[model samples]
Target chain A: MLGDEAEAEDVLQETFLSAFKSIDSFEGRASLSTWLHRIATNAALMRLRKRQPLSFSVDEVTEPGNGNLIPKVFYDWCCLPESELMTQEVRDEMRAAVENLPDTLRVVFLMRDVEGFSTQETADILDLSLSAVKSRLMRARMALRERLSAYFGGAASADMEGTRYE
Target chain B: MSEKHAHRDCSHLLAGLSAYIDGEAEAALCAEIEQHLAACENCRVVVDTLRRTVLLYREEQPAPLPEGGEAAPVQSVRTG
Candidate 1:
């Protein structure tokens, strides 16, 4: 989740050092891995706060039950050849698309998808409700899907999307 | 894509899409989504591409190195 290579390197040391300093405080309520991840997440958040205004809070005001995040891209872009799918250019775009997500959704996406945390684990770690984690993850996926569609299907998706509604 | 189901509410189904994709949705939900997919071309495409999107990210993850601290030795193929 930090997204910067140098920052990640620096944060790794910081997280370990912080964890080392706080080792005695460990209550063992959560798994050792989860505890370490919590520390690392805090370190990342501190770095983010120093870099720029933080975009989200842990208790971000919830949106509507069905927030306006409907899938807008209708084209089937999955048929792209495997060779084209993971090409360097495509990979870069994928990474960029992830970076573009709002911090709230991006963090959840990373914790769940990239960090390999279960949805319940992510919610427990972040102190978010289960539903919040689920909704944020879905929004993140849908947003990335739309961004990626622009590349695989390009303008054709817009045309395909035209007939979506009644 | 049919006119008969054109105005049907697809929003509620959206909430369940991720659960459906993750194989965590209830059997009733799975059945509902499948039945919806049969008639909804747009939803079918969304589900397929959404699944592809998740797979692409998971696939992009680098493979873990071998368990040893250092390089694992490969046996020499050439006979002396």
Candidate 2:
């Protein structure tokens, strides 16, 4: 999410204003909400670009070329019950993990996964090619999974306790 | 399964797992991924957790709307 409240407000206002002006262009291809979201996402991306113009590189995370498919860390949580996976602490960790993603990956992941947009919708919204969206999304999910695994894998509770005592 | 065959490298499969999980992959690719998953524990765990991550996130409420600004009604946007 764009961190600055003032800037986010500006983008929100601009989104609706622009949406109003271009209401005629609403072809009914996407739902009204998706269209609005696309506009808002573009507005936010523009603000992000202005603040850090040089940081918007699609190729920052290298594609996994032909190699072993082994994960950096693997903990089998398939045996864990769904109730355990859905704990508030885990949810908080997941939110934090998503927030920590790089902007490019974060936006794509949020649009596709969090907002329930199709991959194509996300690509269109962010003006990214489909492959780029796919790659960024994969990387984002992988990063979050690795981070969350630390929590579910039992390393996080000790860290949490240390923070509490300190 | 033989060690060589059992530890089948799945880089290609891993690359497509996101699309596969999202139901975006072509049927053939989905079949391939399923076949690989049937034999590979590592890929299975990665895919499973990645899926749960998405589900957990979807369950979260959308970020609070900008403070003090309710969503403009659809009627207003249509008229203005």
What is the iRMS for every candidate structure?
Answer: 7.9, 3.7
Give TM-scores of the second chain, every candidate. 0.67, 0.69
Angstrom error of the Cα, residue A15, model 1: value is: 0.7
Model 2 DockQ reads 0.44
lDDT tens per residue, model 2, A28-101:
99889889999999899988888888769766546446232345656666567777777777777877888787
Question: Which sections of candidate 2 miss by over 4 Å?
Answer: A4-6, A24-30, A58-70, A155-166, B1-8, B71-80
lDDT, candidate 2, B15-69, per-residue tens? 7877887888999999999998888776777888878777777877776776466
Model 1: interface root-mean-square deviation in Å: 7.9
For candidate 1, write residues A69-127 as lDDT tens digits.
Answer: 57666768788789878888888889999999887788898888778899988988877
Reference-based TM-score, model 2: 0.77
Model 1: per-residue Cα lDDT at residue A135: 84
Q: Which is the leading candidate under DockQ?
A: 2
Q: lDDT scores for all predictions?
A: 0.78, 0.76
Best of the candidates, lDDT: 1
